[model samples]
Target: MELVVYLAGQIHDDWREQLKQLAEQKGLPLVFKGPQEDHDRSDEIGEAIKGTQPSSIYRDHTASEFNNLRTRIWMNKADVVIAQFGEKYRQWNSAMDASIALATGKPLILIRPESLVHPLKELAQRAQCVVETPEQALEALAYVFE
Candidate 1:
């Protein structure tokens, strides 16, 4: 079966590459998408909201609304949502994406670094499974596929 893997975390290039590798090694027909991968207009929303002044409240609101819509769309299409959360990589957008996944009844897998205390531990607990290592993450994905 074709699966869409949505990896939500800090929008860093290296993180996306790593997740892509993990998805590849799974040997499944998986399409990986994330905030950093920006298949939609997420980047445009980021640019529109960047450094917004108090006078630009309307623009900020519009950008936020647009981003929410895009995130919901992505979440709806995902077979599973894997959120990477840690003290250093915690992001509001990632939390929002996780929330969307929950609301849509999508399987949510939360991954946190083994060494660090997860900043969003409570949030992560809501996932279908909380895992530390990449292997654990893959195992969680396999469970979902089962």
Candidate 2:
């Protein structure tokens, strides 16, 4: 089964890169989306990540109500959703994704930033698991995919 992870776009570069590596390693598909950086940049970014290619691209971006609707539509087809809720918190987008994941009862993996930490010890108490390192992420991935 393939799981769709809702990644945080504003995340640290290293983290995002690590996530991509992890996805490839796990043979899982991932994608991230945001207000097109610009009309031109949007196409470039979208093509690079999504393209018309037959690859799984996870679209994780701050979404408005309408955007959230679109996200939900996409998410329903996913096996799971992994969201990185670092120090920065945008109530609408982050919470919206989390809530949807919760409502759908899909597995949710919450990744905290290495630098800025989360006060909540158990980020996702109900999440299949909460992880701190990339390696941990892989372990969690195994569980979700298996």
Candidate 3:
């Protein structure tokens, strides 16, 4: 079964890379359909246009819309959806994704750092497993994939 990791939190490059490594170590094919991945180049573009005319600034609304569409498509194809709710308190997007996963009948694995207070702890309860560590997250993944 293919696993698509839809990371839903502040896209800390190191954290994202860690999750990617985890998937690789597990030998699972992973797809990350996150806004951060889609907007990786946006910061550079924004910097380049900082001094340019407001009209000259590039605003790719279509890109974001398309990304959302792609995320839903990927969610449908995924065997499991791992919602990584990092220490940060961003809940709206991840919550929505979790809801979608539940609606689609896909197993949802919610992960958070043990030291942080998870804002969506309630929503996490609805998942197949709510893990506080990388090891626990991996275990949860193993159970679901099994």
- What residue runs in model 3 are displaced by over 4 Å at the alpha carbon? 1-5, 28-63, 114-118, 144-146
Q: Give candidate 3's error at residue 33 in angstroms.
A: 4.9
Is candidate 1 or 2 superior in lDDT?
1
CA lDDT of every candidate: 0.70, 0.55, 0.65
Measured on C-alpha atoms, candidate 3 has an lDDT of: 0.65
Worst 10 residues of 1 by lDDT: 35-44
lDDT of 2 by residue, 52-140 (tens): 43443332231223344556676676666666655654434445565677788877766656553445354466666666665676567
Order the numbered candidates by TM-score, best leading: 1, 3, 2
Output candidate 3 Cα RMSD: 4.7
TM-scores across all candidates?
Answer: 0.73, 0.58, 0.67
Scored by TM-score, the top model is 1
Pick by lDDT: 1 or 3, better one: 1
Please estimate how well model 1 matches the true structure, expressed as its whole-model Cα lDDT: 0.70
What would the per-residue lDDT of candidate 1 be over residues 1-146, giving only the tens digit for each residue?
88888877666446657656776777757787765355345535644556453555655676667666666677778988987765565467777778888888888887777654446667667888887754577676666567
**Pick by lDDT: 2 or 3, better one:** 3
Best by lDDT: 1
Q: What is the C-alpha lDDT profile of model 3 across 1-146, one tens digit per residue? A: 56666655455445567767887888766676555454455434443444333342344443345456766877887777777666655556677788888888988877667654456667767888888765576666666566
Candidate 2 clash pair list? 30-57, 30-58, 31-57, 31-58, 31-59, 32-58, 32-59, 32-60, 33-60
- Runs in model 2 lying further than 4 Å from the true structure: 8-14, 26-63, 88-92, 113-123, 144-146
Alpha carbon deviation, residue 135, candidate 2 (Å): 4.3
